[model samples]
Target chain A: MMDFISYTCLIVGVIFWFWGTIPLLSERSVLFKLHSLSVSDTLGSMSIIFGLLLKIPREWPLLVLAIVCLVLWNTMLGYVLAYCSSSGEKRENR
Target chain B: MVGHLIFRLTIWFLLTANLSWLNILIGLSISLLLPRGYTNPETLKEWLSILGKILWAIPLAYIEAFDLILRPHNDEDMVCEQVEKKRSHRLVFLDILLITFTPKTIVVKYHEEGWYEVHRVTRRKKP
Candidate 1:
């Protein structure tokens, strides 16, 4: 049902947000954490959006497109942020 | 070989708007994109993780920051109490916060009850 879908997506989002907080959850590498979060943001958001789409009436194509765009945008942001943080180290080394 | 075919097949199934195969495909893609190599910030995974930690830590760190002169520790929190009438940058909490991000001018105000708060901030510093 709609309730099941929504809950599943939301629970996953919460898990993604809380994932890095655990000590030694992944490696200590900040880059790894960012990588994990990128997955979290993209797929987590996708899950939530997809769940919402199911609740709506018709317009399947539009909803799917919207979800795709959201995923793409979030992925891009993650990429840029990841690069910026690592580039800092390069600058420091120079 | 097998992985590539599976990945492509998953994508084909996904195009049909099938949710069943979506999660599986996304999980695999994430794993593939993750950087693998020497334990350095040379890969995409390492880079993303760093940004993640910084973004994650910011709110918690800003909340914990104090607004006064405080004791210094190894390198986490940058605080230094004047000892033996000699001063040293003992890596106070704030200092660590400052260096952790970009450099900045931080303003601290002192209160009567051994307390302080971050009042202001400014520019980049040598990392």
Candidate 2:
């Protein structure tokens, strides 16, 4: 049963990763594409990590750190990218 | 606060993942030696309150996301734009931290005068 669940999670994660890319080809605004991509990507990666955690219970320490870093770093990177683009645009309009 | 110390200790234990007496001693001493970042009691209290608000807001935000995605509505094509002004950097950071995690809202741009342009799906017609 555990093996079955693990494989299911792995497959679902892969599906999410590919699904996120579908939005990238759309004509939506940059931020909209970015939002869909990042959110789905993060969720997919987190699901994979959780599956690994289940597979290797002894490696809880590293897995826990991965989860925390994934949540914090992804959001920070998104904000930084958004801020940098806007600031650059402001300089150009001046 | 005791809660803060306990939280740190819990993280320390999780990182170390060993319950030996020497490890405990090391963790205790190191945590004690580390400087507490907040000095002002009032500021700390204010930060704690803000944190509480963020925690409370997170679940509601996710619920809102689910409603927006799963329900059919006429305003599906509409995007809500919000320009928040006069916000401190810390507050803005906290907002981004909470908003991005929800999977429905995103911070598009932040500019001078503390204007934060956030893009959210579903037109609520309210700022």
Candidate 3:
């Protein structure tokens, strides 16, 4: 059962990664694309790491650290990117 | 102050993943030696509530991601949200983090007037 769940999580994470990346190809606003991309990518990476943690419980500390870093840094990075892009647009308009 | 120290210590232990005395000593000293900025007085209850909200956002984020994938977005809007008076930088940072962590909203700017310029994506309604 554990193995099955681990595999499922890994598969779902990969699917999330693809779902998020596919939007980059579309002609949407930068912030719009970023919103989807950041959300899915962070979720996908966390899910994958969680699956690994379950598979190898011995390395749980590292895996947990990875999840924490992903959540904090990915969110911060997304905000920074959005802020920079929007501020640039404002500068051009003014 | 104590909370920040504990948080740093937790990160140190997570990074080292060891319980050796030497490792503990090093981690303790490093965390203590790190310079900290001025901190505003925030109640522990408020901090924990925010932390709980962040934890809750994880599951909610997954749900929102699925919702985004299944439905097409109808339009995007820029909305301004008022923030509390005497807000700490940490609170503002977490606010932006939580908003952007979810699939539908991203904070564009934080104004001096205690307002956040948020960009949100609205999805289509079901027929």
Estimated TM-score per prediction? 0.36, 0.69, 0.94
Chain A vs native chain A, TM-score per candidate: 0.67, 0.82, 0.94
Write the residue-wise lDDT of candidate 2 on B47-71 in tens digits.
Answer: 7877797778645644553453455
Q: Tens digits of per-residue lDDT for model 3 on A12-81?
A: 8999899889889999989889877875689888889888988999988889998999989988888889
DockQ top scorer: 3
lDDT for each residue of candidate 1 in B26-112, tens digit (9 for 90 to 100): 756755665543321234553355457656653433232221102211121223223122212222322323323321112122223
In candidate 2, list every pair of residues with a backbone clash.
none
Evaluate residue A92 in candidate 2 and report its C-alpha lDDT on the 0 to 100 scale: 87
Q: Over the stretch B38-70, how does candidate 3's per-residue lDDT look in tens digits?
A: 968788888998999998998999998888878
What are the runs in model 2 whose C-alpha is more than 4 Å off?
A25-28, B39-93, B108-116, B122-127
Error of 2 at B90 (Å): 6.7
Q: Is candidate 2 or candidate 3 better by lDDT?
A: 3
Give DockQ for candidates 1 onward, in order.
0.04, 0.38, 0.86
The TM-score leader among the candidates is 3
Q: Rank the candidates by lDDT, best first.
A: 3, 2, 1
Write candidate 2's Cα lDDT for A1-94 as tens digits: 8877878767766776776667788786666665666646666677788888888788898789887788789877777776676568779889
